[model samples]
Target: MKILYILCLLISTQVFSQDDSFAKEYFKNGDYEKALFEYKKLYAQSSSNINYISQIITTHQQLEQYAEAETFITELIQRVDYPSFLVELGYNYQLKKDMAQANLSYRKALASIDENPNNVFAVARSFQNHTLLNEAIIAYEKAMVLKPDYNFNLQLAQLYGEQGNIEKMFISYIDFAEANPLSLGNIKRAINDFISEKSENENNVIFRKIILKKLQQEPNLLWNELLSWLFIQQKDFKKAFAQEKAIFNRQPESLLRIEELAAIASNENELDIAKEIYIFITQTAQDANTLLEAHYNLMQLETKQSSKENYQAIDATYQELFKKFGTFSQTLKLQIAYAHFLAFYKNDTKKATSFLEKTLELPLSELQKAEVKLELGDILVLQEKFNDALIYYTQIQRNLKNSTISQEARYKVAKASYYKGDFKWAESQLKILKSSTSQLIANDALDLKLLITDNKYEDSLQTALKLYAKADLLSFQNRNDESIALLSKILNEHKTEPIIPQALFKQAQLYEDKIQFDKAEANYEAIIANYRDGILVDDAYFKLAELYENKLNQPEKAKALYEKIIFDHADSIYFVDARKKYRALRGDAIN
Candidate 1:
């Protein structure tokens, strides 16, 4: 008997669900009378369902039967003590241009919240749904006052933001974040819509002042952290560093935040401040790993700024660090960096190769070993020992298959083949890597594969293609001047070839690195003017826009170029960044 009863219940539920779906479909298809009939039938079967009641009311309104909708809502209010029904009734009155009755009904709903604080949620939500901003705000505020434990700051903040009450919105958001600390990140993201990269932006200034006042009054680390975030957004790393230091002093448990700040500054090209922060870490960090990382970052910054005359000093510093912290797996990155410096910067490939060979003897994990071998392969490639480089790269692929490092090794193998002028083999390897797990590797592979397939058949000897590969190899070897000159040769001699645009783009990058802005501008302009239909035109537009904005101080020109990428090359990889730059240059208030 019980089993039979369960089966019947299941059938009943399935039938009801089907009925509800049919009602919704009717309503969606604009067959309102049929929808109303179905809804009434469903409501008759389950009169206690608020969804059915609400849908009945809404369908009446949709049919423009305002009097009928008001009557239905009034009957619901009489049947139950539900306060939100008053909002429906009031809205029905408002639709009929009876503002006086609508206001009276709304007042009754607000009064219900006074009798029961929990009604505030429903009442405020109803008001907000009806676009009654002031009533909703009043409802929330009254609830919080009557029930001190109640928290509606987040809702209130959003409502205030919608009303354009910026100060109140910010204060409420901060209050909500203070009560729910875990929501701080979400609050920052919400607040980010109103601020810009400029420190002096009005909203940014307002946010900063609020944080400063909070800091002065309460002296909380949360305020400090927020201040640091704001300063970082403004690219005021120095002020951000100050805030980070204050937090570190009080906490003293971690330098992670400070280390992250240094990296951010470094990425922003605030190298001096990055060095300052890293030096502080090296002095105060107790953990061996942290100290080593700080030293490594500091050394990297110094090396980036050092001239050939200062190379010996940088080498001495590297030796000192290795001696201070014994050569082991812990310092693997620094060791690899030192090897790269030796081979690439000091032009001592023999010593760099021998050093890495010794370092390979260290106890290391598979990934760590791959890291070392990858650098070794790069050094071999630098030495033009392409076959030898392939051996190391192949070892990594065999040892760590399906990993990012393995994919990187495969890309290296393809690149080495490309450099050796084995276009057929290179194309095969690159085709395999087009779907690699690593996006960077996939992009590189696709680019190299396209380069080979595009220009290889243009000449019987593949002369222009081979020359392009040689220029790319010179770029990898850090021979920028020679790379630029070779690309110039390709541009002059291979003008009619499809590879001319690629050469021009490549040379423009080298020119930028050499700080020859005018030359870079000319190269990019050539690609833009002559190769408007080429794949690299978008790349040219974006790079030249950045050059004009940052190097040439021609914001209008940059804006126009970015507009080209925005409107013409929607699928280009640079489209998103170009649009952002274009908006920032145009002073569009970012949201």
Candidate 2:
């Protein structure tokens, strides 16, 4: 008798499982009638299973049988005494457009939360689903008050942001961060939603005031860090430097964060503030390595902004670094920088090559030697010595197989081959590099590969491609005027070819580099108007938008162009940045 009973129980379980699967399949396929029938069978087998009961009600609602859904939910509430059923009942009434009954049911749901604080999440979620956000907020607040351990500040902040209540959002997030200091990273990420483009904007002002007030009341170090972050985002490097100094003063371990801020300032073109920050680091850094790097970076910034007349003084700065650091492997980067400066600015490739070759004799790792060789190869390329440059690049590729440096060397080889008019060899090398580990190298490889493959087939002798290659080499050599003229020839002669757009875009870039904004704008506009369906359309749009926003101060036009990328070119690489710019221009703080 016992064995027969166990077999019957197993058989019954198998039958129920099959029916549950059938119910889910019908629900997924939107066969609500069949779903309801199956769910009813499941409910009869296990009347206490809330899953089956809920599915029965939901299927009825999905089928627009609201009266049936209400009847079922009412019976379930009576049987189970569950508070969440009140919310489900309210949802059904909302679907029926019975606002009075919906409000009553929703109130009952909230009142039930007072009796059982654990029901807060479900009640709030239901209210949120019905778009009754105020009630949801109340439910969350009530839970927090009743149970001090309850923390739903994240949800509250998001809801407050949705309502555009910036102050409340900031307060909630700040409170949450203070309570759970380990979650400061998440809090900062959340606060970024309310940061405006302009630091002086209302939201920024409110945030700054709040942090400042918090500092007065309680000097939490996290406030200082957050303030520093906010200043960096606003590009206020001076203020950020001061805050970072405060942090270092309190901790006194390293100047790493300050060095990073200096780099950020330099990148944003705030050269003066960047120089000041780096100078401070050079003077105050306790470590020799940090001091050396600071000096090197400071001189690099000066070199970039220096004129021909200023090169001698910059040269003196380089000599001072060499004197201080000596010709060691640690000074390899400085040595290479000096080599480039000499080769390009001072126009002395012989000295540059001779100096780099000397530095290669230093006690160095294989990677360090490859670094020096790479720069030397670049200098050789600058001198149009393709064969000599190829020798160096090939050495690196052979020495460091499948590494990032190897991929870089391979790209240089392809570029040098292209420059030397060996299009076939260049195309072959580029094909391998199309999957390079380095994104910059891979992108460059693909661009050069397309430039060759697209134009090589047009002329067997590769006349236009050779000219374009020479133009590209000239541009690399900083002979901008000649590059522009050569590109112009391509445009005028190859008017009906695919290379015209490429030429136009290249020349536009050259014009922008020379600060001739009007000509650059015209060229970009021509590409957009002519090559609407071309691969370069999105590129042209983004470039033109940047020119208008930065050079011409026409934010409206820039916004429209950015919107085009957001709406049309969603697959373009520039979509994320374009959307950010668009939101900034529209004065939306949530970007």
Which candidate achieves the best TM-score against the true structure?
1
C-alpha lDDT of candidate 2 relative to the true structure:
0.88
lDDT of 1 by residue, 518-544 (tens): 999999999888889888998899989
Provide the lDDT at 88 for model 2: 88
TM-score of each: 0.92, 0.91
Best by lDDT: 1
Predicted structure 2, TM vs. truth: 0.91
Q: lDDT of each structure? A: 0.90, 0.88
Query: What tens-digit string does per-residue lDDT give for candidate 2 at 1-591?
Result: 423533544566555665699999999999999999999988889665556766888899999999999998898777655667798898899899998998899899999878988889768987787677788888999999999999988888888888889999898888888888999889988887678657987889999998999999987888898899889878788898899999989988888989989989998889999999999998898787898899889888898788899999998888887887787988888899999999977889999999999998888898999999999999999999999999999999999899999999999999999998999999999999999989999998998888888888887788788888999999988789999999999888878777888889999999998999999999999999999998899999999999998889999999999999999999999999999889878998775
Q: Give the deviation of candidate 2 from the true structure as CA RMSD.
A: 4.5
